[model samples]
Target: MLNVALFDKTAKEWREENKDLKGNMRDYASLNELLVLANMESFNAILIEKGLEQKERMIELRKLARNQMLSLEKLNKGNLKQLEDKKK
Candidate 1:
């Protein structure tokens, strides 16, 4: 099972660690969210396709990447929530 609390803490730490990120990585939260969505879609794509051995290996790679993206997104969600809470 995935740990939401851990993700949140990780996000907060990421924010602190990259407070001054610029250019493409500036919108950390938004970027992470996009990554999460893309990862999920790709993961679904892998399972939806009934292909050969090489294709299966490629799909597995995609799933691995998706998992990583989701973890980052969870962290981003936690960080954003913490910021919102602080503003309250």
Candidate 2:
């Protein structure tokens, strides 16, 4: 089960902290960028909770996090392309 609250809080915090870097929320690129940062922070917190002894798990988590970010980027690009096509 995914924790919606945790991700929402992380996303809000990221928005608050990076107000200067923020782009319009309606834009797919901007929205995806925010989500990626939020996910990274959430994953970092989970990694910290796992502690140092879980070396193998930590490595796996890092890879998972990277893949998740890349996936989000690809999805955002695809979504934007679709939107552009619709606008044509």
Candidate 3:
């Protein structure tokens, strides 16, 4: 699961560790890299905190992504079932 809390915590740690840095560009870039890596590693489900300005939009996107995932899962299952039936 892609927990926002965990990301937040990790970002904070990175910020703290890089407090002497002059700009926030590096911090944000590092966070983006980490997120990309996590996604590539098969992380799913994002948990965000409440009161976010774009909460509704984020929720909608999440739902859409989840539905797509479900659809893909169903498709794979159907293909597997067909393969098994053919073998039998």
Candidate 4:
């Protein structure tokens, strides 16, 4: 479900699509993706404790994934630009 929210696919779906590949989709996830997955796991636990419905949790998780990914990407680009500027 978390995978569905973040990657828009389930572990089973990923495995079926990547039969030739080894390990699960997570094994092939980017650093940013893995970070978001961890955060989502924790957030999911909180949502579960709060008695939120699966649909509601999924909506919230997807929002978190999108926002966090964008923020991380921007931060990474900004840091890379800073490094390149320092080298110049």
Candidate 5:
């Protein structure tokens, strides 16, 4: 039985180590999704915990998520600017 807490802790640690993240700290969904991305390091790390692989691939899905978030932020900002422009 894979204890979700272990991964949860790992994800929390990653978040804490990466100070750039802002907002709610409890990101269970993100962590679980990261583990699902076998191409990423998070899956490798989790697998290594069980000696499932000789070499773990650190995929780091969080980085991708962050990139997406940044893109969304930019898009929203651009929209807001357009709204302001329209108002003027």
Candidate 6:
């Protein structure tokens, strides 16, 4: 479910698409993606303890993943720009 929320595909789907790959989709995930997955796992536990339904939890996790990824991308670009400016 978390995989679906973040990557829009399940492990089985990824496997089907990458037959020659050595590992799962997560093995190829970016640093930011790994971070978000960890965070989602934690959040999912809390949501489960709260008795939230699977559908509701999926929606919440998707929103969280999207927002966090967008913020990370913006921050990374800003840092990269700063580094380029410093090299000038």
TM-scores of all candidate predictions against the true structure: 0.37, 0.43, 0.40, 0.97, 0.37, 0.98
Q: lDDT per residue, candidate 1, 1-88, as tens digits?
A: 0112113334445666677865332244465545554554565456556553654645564556557776877887999999999999
Candidate 6 per-residue C-alpha lDDT over 18-51 given as tens digits, one digit per residue, 9 for 90 to 100 = 9999999999999999999999999999999999
All models: lDDT?
0.53, 0.56, 0.49, 0.98, 0.49, 0.98
* lDDT for each residue of candidate 5 in 1-88, tens digit (9 for 90 to 100): 1122224345556677767877534453454343443334455466677666342222333444445556656777999999999999
Candidate 6: lDDT over CA atoms? 0.98
Candidate 2's TM-score reads 0.43
Clashing pairs in 5: 40-58, 40-59, 41-58, 41-59, 41-60
- Measured by TM-score, the strongest candidate is 6
Instruction: Name the lDDT value of residue 68 in candidate 1.
Output: 78
Could you give candidate 3's per-residue lDDT for residues 6-77 as a string of tens digits?
233454566676888865433455443444435523422333333334455345445544555566667779
How many residue pairs clash (N, CA or C atoms closer than 3 angstroms) in each of the candidate models, in the order given?
Answer: 0, 0, 0, 0, 5, 0
Better of 1 and 4 by TM-score: 4
- lDDT score, candidate 4, position 35: 100
Looking at model 1, report the run of 10 residues with the lowest lDDT sum. Answer: 1-10
- Report how far off residue 61 is in candidate 3 (Å): 0.7
Give the TM-score (vs. native) of candidate 5. 0.37
Which has the higher TM-score value, candidate number 2 or candidate number 5? Answer: 2
Task: Evaluate residue 32 in candidate 5 and report its C-alpha lDDT on the 0 to 100 scale.
Answer: 38
